[model samples]
Target: MSSPTTPVRRRCTLVAPGSDERKIAKALESAADEVVLDLEDAVTSARKDEARALVCRTIRELRTGRSISVRVNGLGTEWARDDLRTVGALDGVGIVLPKVDTADDLITADRLLAELGSTARLQALVETPQGVRSIDEICSATGRLEAVVIGYADLGAALGRVGGYTAERWLHVQDRILIAARAAGIQAIDGPHLSILDDAGFRAAAQWTRDLGFDGKWVIHPGQIDATTEIFTPTSAAVEHARRVLDAMAEAETTGAGAAQLDGHMLDEAVAVAARRVLAQTGG
Candidate 1:
């Protein structure tokens, strides 16, 4: 019998890189499109150096599947510089940046990363009132900026409240962030759910985010990954319908098919495109 081979890339897209070596490695195997080995908020001030070293080595040693990212501390901090210096020296460090506030913040960080001889793609955090205020500038900062993660907890903090989903309000802000990212042609990963115990809230939030046109969301707890994966995965029924729509239309040699009957149920081009995207994501 032949040994099973590793996939060139895996299915998960919610970025969840756990703290510490063992759990982080476990997550890498579990299926996150990318795992950010967080060195900023997740790592306390005292353990910054330890996390830095661990991440740098993990870059060299982790199995190939999901992309590896490290969220270094903000600029102007001692640890931030060392963290950048260390991770920047290693290969396969995909993205590293501080919590961005303004265009200046992103521009300065992009330059610092370049100065460190890093070609890592950048991901900015749209977390503060200031950050959201300057969304256009931050989104337009540099072509190297590949993603903008909407930082819900931080945004809630800046709003002077302990945060949880208030659908009417937060959803509006999230839409703005998502639109900005889409306008810039960058991926949007909604911030992680801080509420570990409230799985109901987490799942609902994840589903709402997926509907909001976000490419993905951040995952803090491993428990959150299941909801992330479930909500985000394109369903089998949808996939089959998409296949039928495209196949039937191809045979008819027409386009822009709308809410018309297909196998006795209504189908539309809009729904068909969505299904096709799922197939593309699954490499079907």
Candidate 2:
């Protein structure tokens, strides 16, 4: 798990193929809050070993300003153990476990990393039906777990859905994952919007997730990073309002009142908490 003292922020997480040096390099240069070096789905089976080796070396030599994570193969796959054995040993890196279906999966992964003396944090990629059903348990399974990411594409395929981007289509699962993540006190990340060329659709999806209280979203291309960040980050106006709310609450406290009026709206402890959250999100 991520250390409580040093929080991991993921307003935009860019996914790059572990086997593609060019793409990885480009991803490292992007302004994405985090970059995920993928060894699953993106890399072919024939190059799994090569990709794993490449990812290990990249993690060891990484000097990027953003956080780094590696999406390893699923727990059922033959390559997963070795991927964990190697990448899980790297300190400060995030280990993204895909197709996480149960609490046992996380418990097992935690044990493996513990055995390796790894300081890497774990992020659960919940894509399967079983995984969604077990989402709450998975979130609380291990202290190593840092984030719960909703993998909508694979989840849609698994659920036999054929549809375009529609908020109504994914609302249930999105809410389910978000509630579970909040309950577990971890980050909730929305999956990537697959239509990379549709800038409007991408922004819409990012905005929808942000409005739904997701901490961030995944971006498959470097081109999507800036938009995702912009969509998730607190705006200057919002930050200023939050600061005013906090100041009003502080003034009320000095006057020995439990509540205050800010811009004609009543502000109480609950409102103050929300204001503080807004400031914290922007590091204000």
Candidate 3:
């Protein structure tokens, strides 16, 4: 069995409105690797308590094999503490804290979960400039920290680039989140693409983030789940090449050689490590 710290294969995380049972049910049946029953942005202030109750009930009833996470309201909010206290004790349900600006936020949440006797993992949302700047500290804050999700919509608004993000405009911030999470040995997930109708644009964005080393992305709509999963998972050809690289390395090791030439390219320990990463991703 995988540990809580083990990086689960979360290629696509579908976000559903917590107050809407029908939508939440549909999301549970979707092809998403994970389903985030959202109680924050998806719920209005008037429906906050209702959404929390609905989300807790849905988590208790749903039996989807996919990972389930709840996007709770940020700290200092009227509903945040109750949200954690109520949903935090459920088995196999993780908490996603939005607008996490400091390490203390995660630390407090971690302690609260412990106090409630809940072992649910934590995923931090880096949405503001303060969150982005403090990502490294937040990621290293607690062992319950499983992933760091880049909230592009909020981040863009914070940075005054709300219309759309060009590669040159957002790459640095995106990479900063990626690097911070990776450095702390946690999953780094990219934010959602607001263009729900533009499949091509979505694919391009997913590919860009994948190349930047994000573990996965948030899917605001069910339509984006399949493509996101395909983009994040290792391709068959790449997996085959990775196996060959490992085989060649093993053969070279027997001969006391530190490196070898394979397919007209040099294969060394670094190449072997990358190949192993590919195999690991594929569960090979």
Using TM-score as the yardstick, the better of models 1 and 3 is: 3
Using all chains and alpha carbons, the TM-scores for the candidates as numbered come to 0.78, 0.91, 0.90
Runs in model 1 deviating more than 4 A are 1-19, 237-280
Local accuracy of candidate 3 as per-residue lDDT tens digits, 166-217: 6557888888888788678788898888677546778999999989888889
What's the number of clashes in each of the models?
0, 1, 0
Q: Candidate 2, TM-score vs. the true structure?
A: 0.91
- Model 3 spans with C-alpha error above 4 angstroms: 1-4, 247-273
Q: Rank the candidates by TM-score, best first.
A: 2, 3, 1
User: Relative to the true structure, how large is the alpha-carbon lDDT of every model?
Assistant: 0.69, 0.87, 0.85
Q: After superposing candidate 2 on the true structure, give the runs of residues whose Cα lies further than 4 Å from its correct spot.
A: 1-3, 248-269
lDDT of 1 by residue, 111-133 (tens): 77789878766678777888888
* lDDT score of residue 57 within candidate 3: 82
Q: Between prediction 2 and prediction 3, which has the larger lDDT? A: 2
